[model samples]
Target: MKLSKNFTNPLAANNPVIVQILGICSALAVTVKLEPALVMGLSVTFVTAFSNLIMSLLRNGLPSRIRIIVQLVVIATLVIVVDQFLRAYMYDVSKQLSVYVGLIITNCIVMGRVEAFALGNKPWDSFVDGVANGIGYALILVIVAFFRELFGSGTLFGFDVLARFGYTNNALMLFPPMALIIIGCIIWVHRSINKDLQEK
Candidate 1:
């Protein structure tokens, strides 16, 4: 189904995090916990999906010379809507997310999707592309968050899921450096398994 492509394609092959590295900056910043990471992922998905949809509908009317400007406007407008919604509903998460939510306006993943696919494709196809890439970006962030949060905080979603064990929480995992290391380790494992992705 068309919707399947929109949701699944970004998980691999066209992954925004590993393949394109479009949104790694935020991935490193807010992924210190699974909760914030999940919030960021969901926010990006919403922004990308709607931006793609609207841009596709307007693509036909956009002037070639000012297409980039139009895309920026659409993406910024949707991001603000998303930001305001988050602030109203999840003030804590919004505070934790802070500048990153606003920074979503500059996230290469959203802008890239709008320009590369939405600007040139049908509305439906563009919507699918946005969802797909958002999934891809979220997938990596989730993995990174899972490891960082687990070892860093000794829990997921801040739940005492592993309280039974004598896990000594490594406070270092709570920092950005820990996230960088976790991501590097994941990329190493990924490259090892997919030999073709490694240097010959």
Candidate 2:
């Protein structure tokens, strides 16, 4: 496959979250606010890209039977590094994200791409695939967070908008179920636009 396809496909047609329905845990967990969502998105993106690169480089030497175990070890190490970096530089956000950062090791998007794309592709292509899926995941996160923060608290990244317009915040938006509702809405719209994705 072309490198450009690796880079671009995941942003839409092959999006890890919207299309593939991978990585929904963090997408719903950290997206109650834009800041946390942004941080989580970037963190996942960083981890995915680097881990994909490392895995691609190691692919040839990896034994098929132990590959999954090795992938987990590498992913866990990367997640810890990212968590530590966040604690050092962005303590508050780190605290807010809490266990979610560590949970990246379990994220289906990361493992899925690492195994499905990186193991079989060149390192550069794997990196592009990683970045592409990460961006794809992040795009959904930001969109969900934007709406959640806006309607839930009457703010966008902590700036009041609905309040200024004499509107009351929708308290339901702050809850986890709202995130699913938003995601479902996004899926609905996506499937509507891409008729091929609709159920028969």
Candidate 3:
């Protein structure tokens, strides 16, 4: 049950993106297109999962005085690996992602999970929490990117999906602000559905 909660809560009730409002920058920056958004999401998921597992494994031996520094080092190393991997195989998407890939080291979602959950939890549990939160964040990115790319460019993953229907692409949907609006709508709807998230 404990492991289940760790894996499930972040998907909704404790979502890192919509609920906790963490990692919104990348959500907006990379969601202009579906491909980049998917790549970014998977990258974050990999980093989060491994970072949590590593930190959890080292928690007992890590000195409190240097915990934050150590966490940064671990997170940065993971981010670098992801960045390099993207540059190697997904060069175009990596170029699209730009510095946002490097910025994952400072992402509140990654650091927050490490500090909040990984520090004291067992390795497996922390890994699950990280994967859940990363997926939660990724899910929002995909949804936002789907709408943005589909309507803004009339394409999904660079394929013309709506052109045959005489659908004109909306230029405004390509902007970062549009992603914000979409995320806001998502949050509002999410809160409405999950009444527990609504303010009493």
RMSD to the true structure for each prediction, in A, is: 1.8, 1.1, 0.7
**lDDT, candidates in the order shown:** 0.85, 0.92, 0.94
Q: How do the candidates rank by lDDT, highest first?
A: 3, 2, 1
Off by over 4 Å in 2: none
lDDT of 2: 0.92
Tens-place lDDT per residue, model 3, 27-136, is 98999999999998999999999999999999999999999999999999999999999899999999999999999988999999999999989999999999998999
CA error at residue 112 for candidate 1, angstroms: 0.8
* Per-residue lDDT of candidate 2, residues 115-165 (tens digit): 898999999989988988888999999999999999999898888888999
Best prediction by TM-score: 3
Using lDDT as the measure, the top candidate is 3
- What alpha-carbon RMSD in Å does predicted model 1 have with respect to the real structure? 1.8
Clashes of 1: 1
